[model samples]
Target: MRKRKTPDFLAQAHDPADPNPWLALYLDRSTPLPDEVKKSWLTDSSSNSRQYLLPLLRPIARGFIILIQVLKIFLPRKWSHSRLLHRVLAWGLTRFVSPEANWLILRHFHLGAQILAFIAANSPVPITTTPLEPRNIDDLKDDLFVKHDLNLFNFVIRLNQALRDAGVEMHPPARVDFSMIRDPGLRLEDMPHTRLNFLDLQSAIELFTPLYQLMLTDNDFWRAANSLQLDETIGIYAARLMGAPEHLILVNNKHPLVPMSTLRAGYRLVLHGLSTEMLHSLLMDRKAAQEQPPAEI
Candidate 1:
């Protein structure tokens, strides 16, 4: 198990007062900004000759994502899952991608996995997905499937969270079954053979370092990634299948061209507003149902 190196920028002390220090980097203007944070704003290519071509290369990054979506359709599914290709992509990410960007990518996976595991444990119905036990970056290079699983599980968790928030009484899925996700210590070594679905194209999307690096900075990359909406809808339909179709908000794939932190803040704001409206509507319906007199047997 090769250990991943922590980025200097992320390793620095953040404002302990801020609830989410990493997120505060983009959102909270008042948050403490250290020198390392300022330095991270520079492009990875800033020190090299390629810095001159950044303007031209930067615009190409947007087109690359569109190109990949089209290209994947014509290519065989297996071609994207090649272990050698994944290793090459990992090397590019390690070398060319900024430390902050790499950290965010890995951090996104870890956070997403943890949230999904939480939802799976508390789900009223079984979320019969594979346990997303990801290895460290080096081990992941040879098996990108774990990354794909994380994305899919995250999609599930987002819906589950939304459901739980909407007055659903959630409980452990089974009386004696040990399949549900719990603390990491009890996680299965590998998912059962029947659960393996070798169709995670999200990993391929993530490994496009050539195009992604051209986004100039980690924040820019975050903007581009969010605009693409690659992983947003992964488990939505599955969530609908579980229960309360009306409770889940309709996904809005259109992301504005803005700084990633700004976009994230805006996205959350929209979700909160919508959730409040939904909750009010649900409460009214429940009140009306209760007010109705009993029907004849």
Candidate 2:
């Protein structure tokens, strides 16, 4: 699945301006930003390669990510570095940075790279770059990545089947409800629109956090760093910061280890049979641009 372009940072990364890390990280797409932060981030990201080399370091980056997730999961405590960051950092470093593991770390920049850098230990660093796969999370064939069936190729294919079964067409439903739920055996049409709970399509992805963790562990550091996966991850980091909209049209591009999802050309992921005009509007962000304008827009 292409990383969500909506800029949700929490599941990805926390925006600088966000006051609450947990809340900021988890906010849905369509969330508003405090203008000041947006401009700062825009400039920070595009400023220079040196300013953003964090993406080049994967082990520490994933460590930072695991740190935040662990903190969020077990918050309201002392939250010590020894107890938190160290543990997750240890895990990430062992997984991606280990020289012994075979992966394409040298080719593309993946989200795992920055995440590795962010949480990697600054002191007692390895001088020879020896292999260190964390306990119970080894890259062996019996590891979690294969155990959970979390490969991108599989994820996209499954999602494609879902879209096919839904009979997804070029146009979104004119009166489609964003929030809806179905009772056991309840037909989708039987439920009133107002009774539906808003659906965050990303929820489907969240169902497999364990799998994503496996994905985090199995990747090669340098390859992920160059792929612009961090950029995509950061874009998601930004979107999480922004929060969700009243509605959204979800798409899963299903490509992997190549380009980050949200940053790639939209045409690559637009549903196969969409009309030219509709596809153009979407890729241009023109069709939905005026949607109840931003109050400020």
For each of the candidates, the C-alpha root-mean-square deviation to the true structure, in angstroms, is: 14.8, 21.0
Q: How many residue pairs collide in each prediction?
A: 0, 52
| Residue 99 error, candidate 1, Å | 2.5
Residue pairs in collision within model 1: none
lDDT tens digits, residues 72-134, model 2?
Answer: 455533322322323443354333231211111111112122222211211122111112222
Off by over 4 Å in 1: 1-55, 63-81, 128-135, 145-297
Q: Which ranges of candidate 2 are over 4 A from the true structure?
A: 1-34, 42-86, 89-155, 165-170, 176-297
Best by TM-score: 1
Instruction: State the lDDT at 11 in candidate 2.
Output: 46
After superposition of all CA atoms, the RMSD between model 2 and the true structure is 21.0
By summed lDDT, the worst window of 10 consecutive residues in model 2 runs over 100-109
Write down the lDDT of every candidate, Cα atoms only. Answer: 0.39, 0.28
Tell me the lDDT of model 1 at 266.
Answer: 26
Best by lDDT: 1
Instruction: Looking at model 1, report the run of 10 residues with the lowest lDDT sum.
Output: 192-201
